[model samples]
Target: MPASGQTAERNSHLKAVGFLIGGISSFQIGATVAKGLFPLFGPTGMVGLRVGLAALILLAIWRPTRSGITVQSLKLLLPYGASMAVMNFCFYVALTRLPLGIVVALEFTGPLTLALAGSRRWLDLCWALFVVLGLYLLLRPETMAAGTMHSFDLFGVAAALLSGCGWIVYILTGTRIGRMFDAGHATTLGMTTAGVLLLPWLIPVIPTAIMHPWQGGMAISVAVLSSAVPYILDMLAMRRLSPRDLGILLSMEPMLGAISGLILLHEALSVARWIGVLCIVIASAGNVLTRQKAIAH
Candidate 1:
């Protein structure tokens, strides 16, 4: 590539990076706001309300056509939407039991694993250890007063871990969908599919949302911030960033979530979790900084 082309490519990567950062910040803020609403909506109900409203909002903005409504699209959209639905449901379920930051940190392992899989480099191996250490600190928190270790909510931990698996599917299928359709349209349809998948749960949610207009307003705020904005930004970013790059960049979310939880929700992290997140953040950064050599292949 010529100097001008290289400059343009670099510019594109920078813009994509900005989009991802914005998406992460918006998502954490939205998660904090949604956490406040969980008391009224419950975790499952919140997932329904969020996906439903986000689908509706995105549909209104980006109208879809019937041209690409082939079996092929359905095959991709189904898994994409299903994983998204599962990811959000499990995430909120874990959020109900865990701090927002902790849930995010644990859930991040899915993408991190996907990104870092099959690496042969010594640096990658070292970075992988940092990730493992972070997870260890997360899973094995400080000891209690009685000399026994503090045990986390097992269900929440499992849910968070499962959500990470769903995240892997969501990222892979979502990127494919972005390539096949307009990113905005793909996001709209994908959210709609997720909403449909969770339609049963929306039964109770719809009534409560109607009865409490204030809660409905808050749900809408969440829909815009969490699903609508972030999904679009993420899909756009995926167009430019390889999955490895995406994973490395997204690894920052745990740290960002911790900050958001602290400042907005007044949730304080344990010293162990803070150190864990710091290690993961360091690992994530190392991968990105050393990515240039990997690109040599």
Candidate 2:
């Protein structure tokens, strides 16, 4: 490639990295706000607000038509939308019940599992060990006894794990959907469709809450942060960053979540949990660095 082309490529990669990081950070902030708002909205109610408003905004922007729908496309989108809805629902459920950092840490398992599965070299096992050790530190009973963990919080932790699993499925399915449709349109339509699907539960709750300015603000913030802004940036990044690089960069989310929670929500982490965060970061970083050359091919 020419020098100018190489420089442009580098710039694009940097933007993608930035977008991935920004989106993840916004997600964490959204989580912090939602957690704070949990008392007012309840888990499902909070999700309803976020998804509902996001749906409206995205619908106005993308206006995706179902013109491209086929058995193949529907198969992909169904799972994609389902994964997104379930992931949001479960994460909100977990957020309602547990601390933000713990929930995000546990949720890291989803992408980590995908990373482990895709690797072929023995070196990948080293990264796997780091993630496993991190999970152990985050989830183990011994780690909890130090005032950083609660027994009752385990249920939320499990739900977050389910969210992680759903996220992995969402990523996999979304990749296929991306081939068939514009990502912005697809995500917009998918999210709106998910909102419609959620109406039975949301309609009963959103009305009373929507009348409150504070609750409405929080919901809009969640929509902009978690859905609108990130989705837009992710679309830009997708053009520049390969999927593997995107995953690697996206793995930084847990650490960002922890830091954002600590800073914005006044949540604290014990030394062990901090160490767990480091381990996962190192593991996720390793996956990126090790796979870089391979993925570019």
User: Per-residue lDDT for 182-240 in model 1, tens only?
Assistant: 87888888889999999988878888999999999999999999988887798779889
TM-score of each: 0.88, 0.89
For TM-score, the strongest prediction is: 2
**lDDT per residue, candidate 2, 1-297, as tens digits?**
999999988987898888777777877877787777777778888888888889999998888776888898877777888888888899999877766777787777787788789667888999999988998777665435566834437778889999999889987988788888877877876797678777766787767675788787877898888888888877777777876787677777788888887899887877787788878888888888878766667
Top lDDT model: 1
C-alpha positional error of residue 261 in candidate 1 after TM-score superposition, expressed in Å: 1.2
What C-alpha lDDT values do all the predictions have? Answer: 0.88, 0.80
Candidate 1 residue spans exceeding 4 A from truth = 1-19, 145-148, 232-249
lDDT of 2: 0.80
Query: In candidate 1, what residue range of length 10 has the lowest lDDT sum?
Result: 288-297
